[model samples]
Target: MLLSKAGVTAMLGLATLYTLLPLTWLLLSSTKSREDLFGTNGFALGGETHLAANLSHLFAADGGVYVRWLINTVLYAGVGALLASVFGVAAGYAFDKLTFPGKERLFSLVLLGVMVPGTAMAIPLYLLAAKAGLVNTFWGVFIPGLVFPFGVYLARVFSASYVPDEVLEAARMDGASEFRTFCRIAFPMIAPGFVTIFLFQFTQIWNSFFLPLVMLSDQDLYPVNLGLYVWYSSALTQGHPEDYLLAVVGSLVAVAPLIAVFLMLQRFWKSGMTAGAVK
Candidate 1:
């Protein structure tokens, strides 16, 4: 028993170290200057202290393109996640509760969409957006991001678990319309589920690079991911090698919001997940 426990502890410790190693590297590397990056130890702080300098340079470079990208990312993630969660939960509730014609067939098609790779749809989406004069515009990214099939599926599962037909029927019996019942009763009951869906969709949209890459051409409209790719490519070729540090720092900045959001809403997230497990 002691040997088994010791072995498990060792394996868990190794796993934790493996997971944290890359983040540690990024943190230390972001603090280093170009000269220290190569000369100093990989894990140690560089002789020169220039984290503040690097951040200022990153903001100033290319007329503050990074700031624009940051704003665009927030817009895409925030608005898209809001729309996606609202629509997803509403559709899921309707699918679970309301009876209509061809509902199963339509849901089956949505499931098929879930099975399909998002990358495979990018070109077709781009073509459609071009025809609609949405390409290279904010709508190009926001519209596509709002259509999250996975979020819809999650909402359906959560609705089935969290929402009871009796409660809805009680609301209706109390002279509430369908929309009012959902707003007053069902919505509050499933608030945790809604937050879960929103966080999931927000992370997905924030990290997405391929669809934005195909949809928008203007650098001014690029999200942080695509903007970082631009700087990374330039740094790989002719630009200042120090730009690499900026890219790393920018990557950290881009990921900070997602982490903060998760931490803020983690309790709701856990409750939502566990709510359906037992009952």
Candidate 2:
């Protein structure tokens, strides 16, 4: 019993360390100067207290291009995630509850979309966007992101779990319109699922890079992820190695919002998962 317990504890400790190692490295590395990045112990602080300096440079660099990217990122992720969640939940609920001639076929088509990787469609999406004159614009990123297959899948599962037919029937018998029933009754019941969908879509849109890279050529429209990549690439090729520190700092700053968002909505995430499992 002692040996088994010790072995399990050892495995858990190793897993925890592995999970935390990259974040710890990033935090320590972001605080270091360019010179110290290579020379000093990776986990130790550097001699120069240049974190503030690096942030100022990151914000002010190229006429505050990073700020523009930050704004663009917020707009894309915020709007895209909102629309994705709303549409996903609405469609999922409709498919589950409402009868239609081709519902199954349409849902099968949606499932097929999930099987297709986003990367494979990048060039095609770019071509379509270019033809529609949306290339290099915020709409180019926003529109494509709103079409999330996985969000739809999550919504379908969530709707099936949280929404019951008897409750819907009760609302209908109370003379509630279909829209009213959904808005007042079904929505509240599925609130946790909506929040879960929102968070998932938010993370997906925020972390997306390849689609943005393919669609937008304008640096002013870049998201933080793409913006950081630009700086990293510039540092690699241009010999202005100090940009490295700025990139690291910017990366740390960029991730802060995602962490906060997850922490705030974790209850919904857990509840949604449990609801689905129990149902």
Candidate 3:
């Protein structure tokens, strides 16, 4: 099961290339003017540099609607991921620390939920949202995203490993209520786990397409991904290839914040992933 140094190095090199190749192409393509995009080599950066100009068109296009879509994406993914983390962590902690009837059966159901495909639920969810008169509203999409079964599973794994029984017992002996004990003592210990859940759900929600598409019909409620998709679809109808160019540029811009987030919060991994793996 051991690999030679050459084998390991070759594998690492291929993996790095596989991951970076698309990013490299996106960077090169984004630098081009509309004509240059098709005229030049796909991977080459030789083009009339118009990144700044493209961005200007991108923001000003369609009465500054892209900005609204950007805001919607931030609200949808950022808030939804954060709330998912909170609820998931709380549920996980409860599963680990609290005693109740049918707990194991309920958790087994949650695990089952993790195995269920989100697309399979889309039609049923749309039906329910329609019945509740929540369709095409912000809450319709936002509310559904807050449920993260995988995050709950991760949180439970983390809580069991991170939150020690002695600390909970000590908090109880000091007469702190269960909620207070969790908020004060247990939360800090599992904060890293919460961040892990947040990051995981953030990526999922940010990349979410099918759910948003099904729930929201209003252009104003569209997240960046769906909005860019609309522009891409209209690239030919508008008789301007730049709209297509803008979509590419917009995608490059859309992913930057997520990359920044990962860079900033990656340190939480040592505490969460390692502990979860052990447990």
Candidate 4:
């Protein structure tokens, strides 16, 4: 038993190191000047740290275009995730709690959607967006992100697990309408699910790259991921160290929000997982 416990601890420590090693490199690299970035060992600290200058140059590049990309990313992730969570939760709640014509069939379709890869659907979505005059616009990226089939699936699971049908029935007996019952009783009961779906969708939309690449033509509409891609590509093509440095620093900055968000909502996420395990 002690040997088994030691083995598990060693494995977890190795996994943690593997996960954090790249981030550690990025953190150390971001603090180095351009010369030290290319000149020295990757894991070692720079002789001269220019983290502040690197940040200034990162933001000040090309008339503050990185700032625009950051804003666009926030909108694409934040607004898209919020809308997706609300819609997914509502749909899930309805799926679990209510009966209607062809309900199971409809949910089967949603499950099918979950099986379809987002990359595979990107071209089709672009075509649809083009037909709807949404291509090259914010809505092109924003609208597609709002349709998170996985979130819907999770919501249904959560609704079935977290929300009690007896409470819903009691609410109905007390003269509560369906919407009110859902709003007052069901929604609150499934709060952890809501947070889970929100975090999932938020992370998905934030890290999204391919869809925006296909839909958007204008650089101003680019998300941080795409923007960093542009910078990284430029660095390779033009042999520009400044652009390389910016990309590295930008990557570090981009990861911060995801970490912050997970840290903030980890409590609800853990509860959701616990409920699932119990169920």
Maximum-TM-score candidate: 4
lDDT digits (tens) for residues 135-250 of candidate 4:
99999999998899998899999899888889899999999999999999888778888998999899999999999999999999999999999999999999876899999999
Residue-pair clashes per candidate: 0, 0, 0, 0
- In candidate 1, stretches whose alpha carbon ends up further than 4 angstroms from where it belongs are 1-15, 271-279
Q: Can you write out model 2's per-residue Cα lDDT over 1-279, one digit (the tens) per residue?
A: 999999999999999999788788888887777788878998997544577667778888889988888888888898889888888888888888889899999999889999998899899999999999999888888999889777777777767888899999998999999999888977767777788888988998899999999998888889999989988888899977877777888888888888998898998778766765676
lDDT of all predictions: 0.86, 0.85, 0.88, 0.92
After superposition, candidate 2 runs with Cα above 4 Å error: 1-15, 271-279
Worst 10 residues of 3 by lDDT: 270-279
Give a tens-digit lDDT track for model 1, residues 9-50.
999999999978988887777787877877898999743347
lDDT value, residue 268 of candidate 1: 77
Model 3 has an lDDT value of 0.88
Q: Order of all candidates by lDDT, from best down to worst?
A: 4, 3, 1, 2
Q: Can you give the TM-score per candidate against the true fold?
A: 0.92, 0.92, 0.93, 0.95
The candidate that wins on lDDT is 4
Q: Is candidate 1 or candidate 4 better by TM-score?
A: 4
